[model samples]
Target chain A: MDEKTRRQALKAATLGAAAALASPVAAQMGGSKAQPGGKQDPRSKYPKPPFKSQSQPWPGLASKMNPRPDHGDTSYVGSGRLTGRKALITGGDSGMGRAAAIAFAREGADVAINYLPEEEPDAREVVELIRQAGRKAVALPGDIRTAAFCKDLVAKALAGLGGLDILVCNAARQQSIPSILDVTDEEFDRTMKTNIYAPFWIIRAAVPHLDPGSAIIGTASEQAYNPDGDLYAYAQTKAATMNYVKSLAKQLGPKGIRVNGVAPGPIWTPLQVSGGASQGKLVTFGATAPLGRPGQPAELAGIYVRLAEDDGSYTTGNIYGAGGGQGQP
Target chain B: MRLPLRVLTAGGAALALVAPAFAQGPGSQRTREFVSASAQSDQFEIDEAVTALAQSENPDVRGFATRMIEDHRKTSQALADAVSRSKLAAPPPGIGGDQSMFLSALQSARGSEFDRLYARQQVLAHHAALVTVEVYAASGDDPNLRAVAADTSALIQSHSAMADQLAAKMEEGQARP
Candidate 1:
């Protein structure tokens, strides 16, 4: 499509998403109603596929996404599950990291979030949400693709939050290409640094400060188990993330620290619009899942909470899956 | 690691350890007691560490005192966070009556005497703290405060073990003379 036509199509899709937000189905199926004792049809709880095909520069902002993704700004309620704990979450400006930050704050943790400098706008929203939840919010913006920045990020979080007990290595880099031949050396290196090296550095820096009962959570993906041909580098890094979670759990468990990973299927976030998915794939995102929809970031907030809380004491070295019923587990 | 909130059943040893300081009571009263006691304990630890930093010349004693200040501050902040989350109100953290008495004794000590006293005091303080937190973690009314207790108990246990080591080493050093 031509540039002009593409822009118009983007505008049309945004309007459609806005219209769908107000539809009777969405109005009746309120997101907040899925409380502890409440029940609702899971399949229709959130938006479905045929999403708007949108594009943004690298490291997109969640605020720009059509039908803005929910990071538990309203739906999640905390009962002090993580009260007094301190956490450092990467990519916390959007996606699963944002969801976890909101939940952690509500659960009574002082939170420090790291994101790319471009995501300051989205990070601002998250900082506000955490403060509203009556918890400390520390925003550290830097590129995780560099080892120096990754190390500094952890240090700043430790200093800002005073100490670290929960570390969520949820930030990643994903850019879809038709073939391995199309993947440039720089692109491959960028993916490796962001997905793998960053976590390695951050965890190394953080493990020493984590006392007993500390938790380290890495965000794996469904792509790790079922790799997409185009996402070769990104998929392998997730596999590495899954592998390290098990390995580190064994290494840290004896020291009273728990390590776990979250494998999310097709979750709607800034990733889809910011070159993580091909434009062609964006419209039909999550369409192939059994639920026929993309899981919002809010849907998986509880999984992160469970992994970080003390109640999941015996649940280390495990991968918790949220794949919209596609059976990634 | 943190103990589960509801699943932890206190055994005979745990009850024996807690019996001297705490009396069996209703859940709400127990929670109130835990919160107030925790705040007081944390305050005492911080104040004691500050005094040690000023008085003690031995590297090990000063190092342990520095760690106590940092770790106790975190726990104190956690207690404050729990208090804000619950309906209960906590007084500003201050040393307990017994802690004040202990501090008075430690303040007058000099040189090696100060280090030995600090170690001994740490053993007593952390043992008491361990008992208080373990009891609350085993069965506390508020889920939030129970979590704080569970998390704090792990640190206190570590501190107690360290204190035991320090006290033994200090006594051995004094015996050498």
Candidate 2:
């Protein structure tokens, strides 16, 4: 055989090997059990979670969910990724904010968590958990929509945590409007202020204090990319958030502060349960993604950690999609 | 005699043809089976959690729970596929071993009682899960498992707060009219 023919045959064999390795059935031929002495293996009986749908809103609170979402406890190991660093997370009472807070703590960063007055209990619990993890956690209660409040929040976080190395803009409120026509000007303004403008202010206030190598991460949404007519205002603001991340990355990159965004497909968080979307539309949430399911906050926690730490140092001006294949890469 | 000779020749050819399958890799079959099993186990737990949440009476809880279930389910499938290809054993189910009891207790309660019990269990479960994730992340050799564990740990921490909030709300609602 000619040299070219031999090379072609080798290439085909390599491709065939790779294809066999990539097959789904290849997974089944592996281990039959996860661990010894644990509960009976659950794979034989239960159906997997379905993919996310464009119309679904956030899934609220993780504790109440059945079978429970994976939250790293015994699995995450700290490598001092953020040793002596400080961070402030808005809407840190519960949900994605809380998850980010814990990840920061695990990485050796001190955190100051902000929540509304009514969400004090939720915020306090997270603060305690942070403390238990051997980090200092400060609980600040206020609304992020107010410029004065945002300023105060930054001040308090600086005072309590000393200085900020990372700023996670994660607080937002959502309400479902039947149509764009049904959305009141007031509602649209409110959503934008809370979701978009608040982050802008927080980043602005926090910028001067941020040192080189600092990072800023905004929690955008899958809705930003795939807009539903009903979520016009919320979706618009989220899109703005994405744009802000891109623009800010360019602006902040010069100062050694990286700006990025996390666009979650559909996550279970308090924002969803507390009227982010109308309850009437909650039941069939996360039903249409290619993966056949929505995602949990726990599932998303690692991406934020990676983004904040050195693991994602080279990554900026990028939006990490944790939406379970809902948004294509 | 001619027919017998032909049958023997056919048998010899068949053996020769199939010999490469057994010679492919040592312990490859076992490893693949293990990974597949582990993935399935993870999916089952995630799915069960979602279904339970969807059926919940509280609209708020149900909504949030449904999302968690969906996300976990998707990740679990990906993990399952990975495990199957790796030929590794699946992780065992019920890390703390009391999920059944908790589920049963939850099933027996009604109204606010059910909510309280469910929320409390979530907190406990997440706390335990966090520990498991931490250990796996630190010691597990598999990059995928470690990544999943690390990410899942952060999420569980968030869930712990949500569970506590729901529990508090349930208590408050019970106290009120």
What are the models' TM-scores?
0.60, 0.55
Q: Can you give the DockQ of every candidate in the order shown? A: 0.01, 0.03
Off by over 4 Å in 2: A1-75, B1-177
Candidate 1 chain A, poorest ten consecutive residues by summed lDDT = A13-22
How does candidate 2 fare on TM-score? 0.55
Tell me the tens digit of each residue's lDDT in model 2 across A1-329.
67566445533433333333333332332212211234422233222333232232243444444433333322233445676789899877666787788667766789998877877655665776577556899988887888999998899999999889888999887876645666788888888888988998898999999988899999888788866555778888889888999998999898988999989875655555555643322332443343434455655667778888866778999998876545522
Shift of residue A1 alpha carbon in model 1, Å: 62
Candidate 2, residue A243: the lDDT equals: 92
By lDDT, the best candidate is 1
The candidate that achieves the highest TM-score relative to the unseen native structure: 1
Model 1: DockQ vs. true structure: 0.01
Consecutive 10-residue window with the lowest summed lDDT within model 2 chain B: B92-101
Q: What is candidate 1's CAPRI-style docking category based on DockQ?
A: incorrect
DockQ of candidate 2 compared with the true complex = 0.03
